[model samples]
Target: MQVSREEILHIADLADLNIEEEKIDKYLLNLQDILNFANIVNKQDVSNLEITIGSNEAKNVFRKDEVKVFENTESLLENAPKKEQNMFKIPKVIN
Candidate 1:
């Protein structure tokens, strides 16, 4: 599960990354560590375990949709630096 110097160089070339000669060893070590972790995960014993989507037993906790009008219009618009027709106005981005 170890990453080689050549593999690191190849990856850099594929990604169009300009990895310095000094940093090649560091990159190789980090890549090797990631592969080692993957190897460890692959060796896990999950034969007796069930394939579960989630661990939580609770169902959806969503509330009913409701629309309510704001009572205090003046208070809500008071903080706006640029207000236009009861709405906050922003500078036009696209032509």
Candidate 2:
């Protein structure tokens, strides 16, 4: 598609762009090239190809769910600066 100088100016105005008069020709040529490439891409054939969302042989390899218990509570709260009723305590954060 051939883009006219007036059309380029109108596009620039609609996009709120400050395009110089000398740069308009360059922008027009670039836009034409992009459109031509898009037209070429639109003519591609992908009829036999399958649409895959992720990697080809991907599976969720997760560990089995298991229950574990800790034997020490005092050792876990040793490094805490404040402790109350077997739990760590801190200053109020929200008003």
Candidate 3:
């Protein structure tokens, strides 16, 4: 597949990208290479293969959940730079 400079410019405009004039040719060549590689992959024969979405093997691999004692609040908050009423205080992140 051939990707032209005009097509690249149109795609950039649609995607809100500001591609410099000097880089347009390189971008067009790279896009064409990617399309060519995709074409090659599309021609591969996989008609007899089973459709597997994930790994074929499964294993039991989860830790058992149980109640456990944690350190006191004062000890837990000792490393925090800011704390208020046994809770860690962080800078406001949302408007």
Model 1: ten consecutive residues of lowest lDDT? 50-59
Q: Each model's C-alpha lDDT? A: 0.85, 0.86, 0.85
Clashes of each: 0, 0, 0
Location of the lowest summed lDDT over 10 successive residues in candidate 2: 50-59
Can you write out model 3's per-residue Cα lDDT over 6-82, one digit (the tens) per residue? 88889999999999989888888888888987897679898888776668655667898988878586888998899
Q: Which candidate number would show the highest TM-score if scored against the true structure?
A: 3
* TM-scores of the models, in the order given: 0.43, 0.42, 0.45
Q: Which stretches of candidate 3 lie over 4 Å from their true place?
A: 45-95
Off by over 4 Å in 1: 44-95
Q: Which residue ranges in model 2 land beyond 4 Å of their true spot?
A: 41-95
Better of 1 and 2 by TM-score: 1
lDDT of 1 by residue, 53-75 (tens): 77886478898799988899899
